[model samples]
Target chain A: DVKVTQSSRYLVKRTGEKVFLECVQDMDHENMFWYRQDPGLGLRLIYFSYDVKMKEKGDIPEGYSVSREKKERFSLILESASTNQTSMYLCASSLQGALDTQYFGPGTRLTVL
Target chain B: TQLLEQSPQFLSIQEGENLTVYCNSSSVFSSLQWYRQEPGEGPVLLVTVVTGGEVKKLKRLTFQFGDARKDSSLHITAAQPGDTGLYLCAGPSNTGKLIFGQGTTLQVKP
Candidate 1:
């Protein structure tokens, strides 16, 4: 079975602080994604990486950046966390195909106070 | 822009009840996937339908893809408390990213 793990399950940060959420997959998938899920908003993509050092912005990428220095790890960075940035962050990975199924990690609930 | 719309944002029912959730889209997709997310956990893929007018069954759950490849439905028979979760449908875009629906939260009481 494919497994995706996140660095933290819950995190708290003060306003204007830098925050990082990490994700790792054991399936050796080539595609990884970051998304923030909110009530009534579903899951909005923040960023995605198709390969090492390759990144793409999704629908809502503001105030967020991503790093994919290795195939198994993907990190989401908040330049300066704000209260509005508090959300449940999810990381997913899929095989190198458009129609492949994405396996998601247990989300990290970030609280920006 | 491609968009997927899901109907009945919420549903609550007793055990042994039947329910169905619908997912619609104006744009066509090559495939659609259904996922069930439990509280505090990431969404888990339940099923994926690729061909138009296709039906697939997994235990008491049935999934159907529309003939136009633009819609899908999930029906659960005799739902139990264990079936309670948020159901989400998504389709891959031309850019290879997925577009997700608003999701349907279902609570099956014992």
Candidate 2:
């Protein structure tokens, strides 16, 4: 079975503070993605990495960045946390193909105050 | 930009009831998938439809893809409390990117 793990299940941060959410996968998949899920809006992709050090912006990439230094690790960075940035963050990994199933982590719920 | 629009954003029904969720898109998709997500967890793949007019069944759940390859639907028969969750539909874009819909939140009261 494929397993994806996130660094924190819950996090709290103050405005303008930097936040980092880490994700690790054991499947050695070539694709990793970061997404923020909000009520009604579903899962909106923030950023995705097809290969180590290769990144692409998704629909809602503002105020979010991602790093992929290793095939098993993908990290999401928020330069300055804002109240509006609070949401459920999910990380997923899949193979290089388009039809590959993405395996996701438990998700990190960040609350900004 | 390719967008998937899901209808019945929220649904509350009693156990043993039946419900259907719709996912529509204007652009054609090479493949479509349905996922179910519970609280605190990421979405889990339920089914994937790749061919036009495809229909797949998994126990009490049925998934159908439109003949145009631009729409899909999920139907649950005799819904159970365990069926309550967020149902999401997604498609693969021309760039090999995944695009998800707004999602449908289903609540099955026992």
Candidate 3:
């Protein structure tokens, strides 16, 4: 089975504090993505990395950034956490092709206070 | 903007009942996928439909891709409590970016 793991299942952060969420996939996938899930807004992509050291901005990337130092690990960073950023953050990985199925991590529910 | 609209944002039904969920989009996609997410867990791929008109089945679940390649449907036959979860429909945009629908929350009662 394809396994994707997130650093934290839940987290609390204060305003202006930097937050980092980590993700690791064991499938040796070449593509990784970060998404935030909101109540009515659904899941919005924050950022995606196609390969090591290569990243692209998604539809909603204003407040978030991603790092892919290795093929197995991807990290999402919130420069300065705010209450508006409190949501469930998800990490997903897929093969190099567009049609490849994306495997997702359990998710990190962050609460920005 | 490319968007997928899923109908019946919420569903509640008794065990042994059947249900169908729809996902429609004005934009075309190369492929459409269905996922099921349980509480506190990430979404899991249920099926992927590539052809404009295609049908795939997984046990008690059936999936169909619209002939126009802009829509899809998921039907569950004799839903069990284990089938309760959030159902999501997603498609790839022209740039190969994944676009997701709002999702449907299904609750099957025993």
TM-score of each model's chain B: 0.98, 0.97, 0.97
lDDT of 1 by residue, A1-113 (tens): 99999999999999999999999999999999999999888899999988999999999999999999999999999999999999999999999753578899999999999
True-vs-predicted CA distance for residue A42, candidate 2, Å: 1.6
DockQ of each: 0.73, 0.76, 0.73
Residue-wise C-alpha lDDT for candidate 2, range A69-93, written one tens digit per residue: 9989999999999999999999999
Show where candidate 2 strays beyond 4 Å.
none
Clashes of each: 0, 0, 0
lDDT of 2 by residue, B2-79 (tens): 889999999999999999999999999988999999877889999999999999999999999999999999999999
What lDDT would candidate 3 get against the real structure? 0.93
> What stretches of model 1 exceed 4 Å from their correct place?
none
Among the numbered candidates, top lDDT falls to 1
Cα lDDT for residue A82, candidate 2: 95
* Candidate 3 lDDT tens digits, B3-109: 99998899999999999999999988888999999999999999999999899999999999999999999999999999999999998887778889999999999
Sum up the clashes in candidate 1. 0
